[model samples]
Target: MDNLATTWVGATAKQISRAVRRGDTTATQVVADHLEQIAISDPALTAFRVVRGGEAIVEAEKVDDQEDLANLPLAGVPVAVKENTAVAGLPTWHGSAAARTAVAEEDHEVVRRLRGAGAVVVGVTRMPEMGLWATTDGADGPTRNPWSLDRTPGGSSGGSAAAVAAGLVPIAQGNDGLGSIRIPAACCGLVGLKPGRDVIPCDLGVDNWLGLAENGILATTVADAALGFSVLAGRSPAKLTPPDRLRVGVALRSPVQGVRADEPNRDAVATAAKLLGQAGHDTVTAEPPYTTGVRIAGLLTWFAAAYREAQASGLDLKTLQPRTRRHVRLGKMAWNRGWVRQEQRDAWRAKSLAFFEEKNIDVLLTPALATTPPPADGHSGGSWRHNLIENIRYAPYAGPWNIAGLPAIVVPIGLRPDGLPVGVQFVGKPDSELLLLSIAGVLEVANPWTRHAFV
Candidate 1:
C-alpha cells in the first residue's frame, strides 16, 4: 500500500469515491490502507468483530476493472456494517453467542445496494446482544469510546460509532430499533441518521418484528452521511444544500418520566436551539407527542422482539448472556400481553405524525442523549434490572424518535468539560429526511466539528 494513501483514513466518503473515480488512488489501495488502519487501531478500540480483507480486495479489484466509475457514487469508499445486519459470507453475529454462527446466504437489501454503488465492505462492527441495550458490551467485550477509552461508545451500534469516530472507516452502517444508531453517534461525536419508516427498507434480508428498527449510516460529516444514505437507499447521492428557514421546536424533556437529563446534556439542547435561532430558523420549546404509556408499549415490543430472536436462533439458553436471558424472560412475559403487535406500532407512528402536523413544526431539536457515554465498564456484566435502569438513564432522548418512526439525525454540538462530545438531535416527520439533511448540512458548516480524534 502507498504510504501517502494512508491519508485516505481522513477523507470523507465523497472525497474518497471521487479520488478513486478520478484515478488518484486505486480501490485496492484504499481498501488495503483502511484494513491496515483497522489492524493498527481496532485492537485497542474493539470496534469491529470481523475484517473481510480478502473479500474487500476482490470487490475493490472489480471496481478497478470497471471502465466507467462515474456511475458509482461510492466507487471505492470503505464502509463497516453493524454485525447485526446480514452481509453475504459473514456471520450476522448479533453480539451474542446465542446468535447462530452461520454465514448469511445473501446481503441485506441495504447492503446489496451499497455493493451496487461500488463501495467496499471492510468488516462487521459490534453491538449489544440481540441489540437490546444502549452500551456496546457483549460476549466479546465492551467497545470503548475513541475520545476516552474509559467511556463507552454507546450501543447497540457502538462498534460502528467507535470505528467512524476513530477514523477506522469513513462510514459505518448501523441500525436503530430504539436509538441504537443515534445514541452511538452522539457518544462518538459523529453524524448518525435513522431515516423515517419505509424511507429506507428495514426488513430486507432479516426477519424483524415491530418494524421499529431501520438501517442508517455513521459518518464524520453530514455530507458523508447523506452520500452513504443515498447509496444504501438506492437514490442518487446529491449535495445537501441549505434548507429554508425552518420552524424548529426544542424539547429538553426526557421521554421517560423519572429519567431527567443531566445539566450538560440539557445545555446541549439549549445551545443547539440557540444556534438554530441564530441561523434564522423559528425556535420554540415542544415536547414529544406520545405518552409515557406509548413509550412503555414500544419498549416492551422491542424487548419481545429480542426474546423471539433468541428463541429462533436455537442456541442453548446457557450460552446466552445472563442479561440477555433475563431480557428474554421479561420479553416473553411482555409478549403475553398481546400489545407488541403491528397495529399498536402503527398507531404510535400515526400519533407522532399527527403531533408534527398539529404543531406545524418543520423539525424538532432535542438532546441526543441524557448524559455523555457512561463508564465503559459501567453497565457491563450487570444484572438485567441494573442494565435496564442504567441504559434508560443514559439515553433518555433517543427512543421516542424510533417510537415515532421519524427521520432523526444527531450532530455534535461541541464537547463537555470532561472532553467527551455532546450531540443534539433534529427530528423530522416521516419522509422528511431531505429536509433534516439540509438543515444538518447547514449546521455542519456553521459549527464545523473536528473530524479526527487524537491519534
Candidate 2:
C-alpha cells in the first residue's frame, strides 16, 4: 500500500511550510509523511537514534492550533536533532554506552531556538561514541548510506545525513567538531555547512572553551540550509552579493603530511575550480598555511575535551569503550600540558588568522575528504589506537577548519564512477559565512544534483 503521505518526503522545508501555512496541507499531514517515511526507511538506514512520532504529532497539532503563521517561518517542518544535543524528553547519551540513558530535563539552547522558529523536532539522530569516529556506528548500530547499504553514511552526524538523503526529513540539525556534519553531507550527497565559531548556541550554555565545535544544518538545498541558519542564528544571513572576479584558492593536497587525496577527490577539486572560473572567479592553486604546532595543539585540545566528557560520565573507565578510556587518559595528560603549550596554541591561532586576513583570497577550495566514504565496517575493527590513525588517513582535510574556528562548507560536486558522491570544500575567513554561502549558492545552481537520495 502506497502511503499518500510519502509524497511530501521530497518536499523542501520551505515548500512544506508554504503548503501548510496556505492551508493546502495541514501540519499534521506533513509530520505524518515524515514519520511514515522514517518508519519505512530507517530500518535499512539506521539513521535515527530516537524517533518521536507521537510527540511530533502533538507538536504539529499545536502548530495547527496557532492562529499566526507570520512568526513561524518553519511551521510544522519536521527536523532531526543529533543525539548528542539535548531535547528535553530525549536521551542525550551521545552514542556512549557508559553515559546516562535518561531523557533530558530541558532542551539545549539550539533546540530551543529551532522550536521557537516553528520547526518540529521529529527525532534524535545517531552518532559514534562521543563522536570519536567518522562513521556513524555506535552502541545502537552503523548508519548505512541510502545510495549504498554496504557503505557508511559518515559521522558523527551520519544519521542526520542519512535521514535527509533518504528523504525522511527535509532538514536535520548536526554539530561539527571535526567534520561531523560536512563529512557526512559529502558522503551522502547533501549540503552541509559548519557555521562560524559560536554562530549556533552550544548545548552547555556559552561554555565552549575550545570553540572547535558548532551546531549546523544538513539539508538538500542551499536555501533550506540558509533558512535553518537564519532560524538557529536568530538573524538573517548576509545579503551581500559575491564580488565579481572573486579570488578563489584551489587546494588539492591534504594538510596532513604523507596523506594524499585519491584521484576522484583530486578530480572533484579540479572540477570545482573550473566551475568557479566559469563563474568569474580568479582560481589559483594554493596550499594551506601550516604551522608545525597547530596539529599538536589541536590533538591536545581534543583529548582534553574527551577527558572531561569521560570524567563527567561518572561510569567506571572499564565500562566505557577502549577509545574513550584512552582519550580520557590522554586528555588528562594534555590538560596538564596545556599550561606550557597554551602559548603555542595561541600562536597557531594567530597564524590561522593571519592566513585569512593577510592573504587576499576570498575562498579556499579543497577536497572535502581524502576519499569517498570508505567501507562501512573498514577502519573500525582494529584497536582504538589503530582506528584513530585510520580515521586521520581518511579525513585529513576536516580538522584544520575546526581548529582555526573558521567557517567551511561542503557541497557535492559530482559522483565517482562507482556512483558514490564526491564533494569539494569551501573554507572562508572568520564570520565570512554569508559570502561563502553566496558563492556556494551560485555553484549549486550551475550544477544541480538530485535533491533526493539517488536510491
The most accurate candidate by TM-score is: 1
Candidate 2 per-residue lDDT over residues 274-383, each given as its tens digit: 88888878987768777557777677777877776666666577777677678778888877765325566567667777765566788899999887686666433346
**Per-residue alpha-carbon lDDT of model 1 for 1-455, expressed as tens digits?**
22223777778888999999999999999999888888878888899998998989999999999999999999998899999888998778888756756888999888998889989999999888778889988656788998999999999999999999988889989999889999998999999999987877787223554677888889999889898888878898877777788898888877787877788888888877777788888987778765866777777887888777766666576777788878877888888877567666677778877877778888899888887688887464789889888888889777777766788999988888899998889999778887887888777877888876633
Q: How high is the lDDT of residue 170 in model 2?
A: 95
Give per-model TM-scores. 0.96, 0.95
Model 1 spans with C-alpha error above 4 angstroms? 1-5, 204-207, 378-380
- What's the lDDT for residue 179 in model 2? 85
Q: Which residue pairs clash in candidate 2?
A: none
Candidate 2's displacement at residue 74, Å, is 0.9
Q: Which residue runs does candidate 2 get wrong by more than 4 Å?
A: 1-5, 204-209, 237-243, 339-342, 378-381
Q: Which ten contiguous residues of candidate 1 have the minimum total lDDT?
A: 1-10
